[model samples]
Target chain A: MIARLRDGLAVYFCLLRGALAARMTDRADLGISMIIMLLADLVVPLTTLLVYQHGAGFTGWQRDEALLLQATFLIAKGIAFPFCFGMIWTTTELVREGTFELLLLKPRSTLLLLLGHSFQPEDTGKLLGGIALFCLALPNVTIGADADSSAALLGFAALLLLAVLTLFGFALLMTCLSFVWIGNSRLQEIFDAVSAFALYPHGIFTRSALGWLTWVIPVSVLGYLPASVLLGRPDPALPLAVGGALCFVLVVIGLWRMMLARYASAGG
Target chain B: MNRLLAAWRSTCAIAYATYQEWAAYRSHMLISLFIGPTYFLVQVVIWQALLADGGTIGGYDRTALMSYYGAVLIVSTLVFDFADWNLQMLIRSGKFLTVLLRPMSHRGFALSQKLGHRCLGLWMEALPIWLILWLVFSIRLVPASTGWFVLSLALGFLIMFLVNYCVGTLAFWLTRTAGARRLIGFLRDVCAGVFLPLALFPHELQQLLFFLPFQFITYVPVQVLLGHYELAGIRLGIPEIVGCQALMALLMWGLSELLWRLGIRRFSAAGA
Candidate 1:
């Protein structure tokens, strides 16, 4: 078991190193790309400042808490973007150009290979921006200085993992759709609208709307739940919401397999 | 005069062909039908959440904000520029040589295609948008005159085209600019008040933004539709702001032309 685990680790690192090496050749382009995406990361904090200065915020959340929610989102975006958020586009191009056959020839899992092969280090700018926002908002957020605070922070950290997983799951689902529907990039556009909607506080939504985004769409899992956990005001529906997201991921993986099965290589 | 007439004829022919190309599609038409209204609804919902009591937020009361955004839904949609994405692709794929191989300038072709797309968009999107705004939001264009509003819309289109065209021309020097275009395009959309009223911005910042051409893209035209725009803390009536926007649009058009001339000389097909 130890040897097998070590072999898997070796394979993963090999693929990751290859991706990093390819990106390092174009240092200038990578820097510029990161700066460009970082500009988008900066917009949320700016808007939060504007909204709160107007003396209104989402019902239960204060301005600083809203900023924290946005930071959680940006951090997840930054991590997922570098690992797999961009796979939807990469997979579409690969399938369209008939190069996906090369990916299947690899002995490793195709999805794992896709994850490593499409790393976008340029998204680290978003990570930097998120960290900056988190630091700026931390002083203003109302966290108690007690042992319960440590437990809450730990809970918040776990929810952050859940947010990243949900985000990556969404990207994987989109990538699967690209395999099934070659040249139909329009379906990918809806991801933009869905994500843009996800940045708001959960309070802005009604109970029904909240349930829908949480259970049906899992958009709330992207940012709101983690932020809510940190604020010590997690909804009574937390377990159902998290279970719904896990079930959604399971559904997405099943769909992904079906899509992969349907894909007949253009090269063949 | 003969040369000018030939150019005009070429533009019209391309416009006709492109219009037919787009009109053949039903799915894209359906998508266009939703894009404007969906974007407008996002703004409406967010603003509604923030403005819970329905009193003034910045300088805009709730009704005024609704009217501004309602007009925004129409005008911003009409003036949308989709050239930068296509231009970057053409350059990166070495398809731009096809334009140089042809007799007409690339800029002319780009503008003609845009006009065709927007023409179809108008037929499908404009009337439905007005109905939705009127029925749902009770919004109307309260311009000083129909003539000035129409002029403002035309100039806004020209301004949008010029701003995007300038970015598109950067493909001549850059390796691939799709990423740059998306980021800059988002920045433009946000700064131009697609997602919120620029009037909601503090007055000093608004005054500073007034000097930038980005404000002319959507803010000035919407203000013209609303019959007044504030500049330097002075409220300018519709005619004055429209006059200012006309000059800015003309200036951007000239600058885009100059940039295109400079950029084409740097264009190298073999390396691309």
Candidate 2:
């Protein structure tokens, strides 16, 4: 299992390097895209801060706790930037345009190839801005004041990586659904819209109904649960994280195989 | 009079064409029906949680906030223009030539097409949701006066439509304006009170947002609908909303036309 994981990571990095090379050829355009993404990254958290300050307390969480949640979201978004958003759009487009045939000819797995082709050089800017925010908010985070910063950061990182995997897997699964359903663009839009809810602190959604949706939909997992754990709030079910991570991997693998089976070659 | 008739006829034809375009993609529409409501449900759930402890967050109660957000979702979606996507495609495909050659004004045609699309969206999608909300929630109206509510809501759609057009027309100057579209979208959601009530924002930010035209698009209209604005309040607010929208619309219109002319000149000079 370890060796297989290592191999997958290696392939992922190799694909990323190739994408970077392709994007670097248009440095000026890439720079503009990056700037735009960075601006977008700042708008959400800043706006949320403004909202929280005005509202005083969000659900039960205080102002600082809300800020910490926003920071964690930024961190998870930083992880997602390079990993998922770049690929999801292209995956949908390829399926729609019947361009997956070219991908099939590639030696790499089609899922990886599709994701690899979808890299946005601009996302690096979003990642950097997120990192900057995370750093700025790191010291102010008091929810987990008892825990060592190092331990919290490590735990945060683990949860963030898990979140990204879950998000990417979910996106992949959605893209694969396009194989069965034509004109699934609305599904993509719905995904985009629902994901926007992640911008707010999840503490605002502590009720059981919303909680179920968060866990089942896994959008809250992207930022909320991990942030909670890191902040030294009562730990969420460990099994939830482990189960979600396992489900993500299994789902992605299943969807990829299903997509491959349905792959009718586009005309060369 | 004849010109008005001609314009009306052309607008009707354009409206039909817009409907047909959307109708051709039946699957997308069906999916949108499912998807839009599901996303709205998620938002409702979140808001429900926030309000569970009772209202009075940033001076908004649960019912009021629901009315505001429900109006936001319905109104924003109703007034949304695909002009940005259209402008981008036109520029990329070098099809601005066809639009320019037409005897009718391109801007007029574009605006008509957008309004037509929005109208179709309202009939096909929004009306159902509005009916459902009215039936299920018995959503209370705040503006008290029906006439005022209707007028304000119309103005809201107009402001939103103009903003979309102005933003989209920037594509004439910028090679790619997706960033601008996204930025404007984010602004609309945050400042315009689509995601949360604008009342929930810090007083300073709320004050600043009041100055911006975005609030006129979604926030003020919804506020009016929820009876947050009175006839007296409308006397003060309506002028501000309309004046700001008109000023922004004129400024954007003039700027986009200038850019469009310049872009056309550039294209012609380059022998494209």
The best candidate by DockQ is 1
Q: Which stretches of candidate 1 lie over 4 Å from their true place?
A: A1-11, A144-147, A265-268, B22-29, B32-39, B124-146, B178-183
lDDT of 1 by residue, B84-150 (tens): 7787778778888888999888878888888888888787777678777877767765566778888
Compute the lDDT for candidate 2. 0.66
lDDT of 1 by residue, A167-252 (tens): 77889888887776665556556666677667888667677877778889888878888877777777677888899889988898
Interface RMSD of 2: 3.7
Error of 1 at A218 (Å): 1.1
Worst 10 residues of 1 chain B by lDDT: B26-35
Question: All candidates' lDDT scores?
Answer: 0.79, 0.66
- Model 2, native contacts kept: 0.32
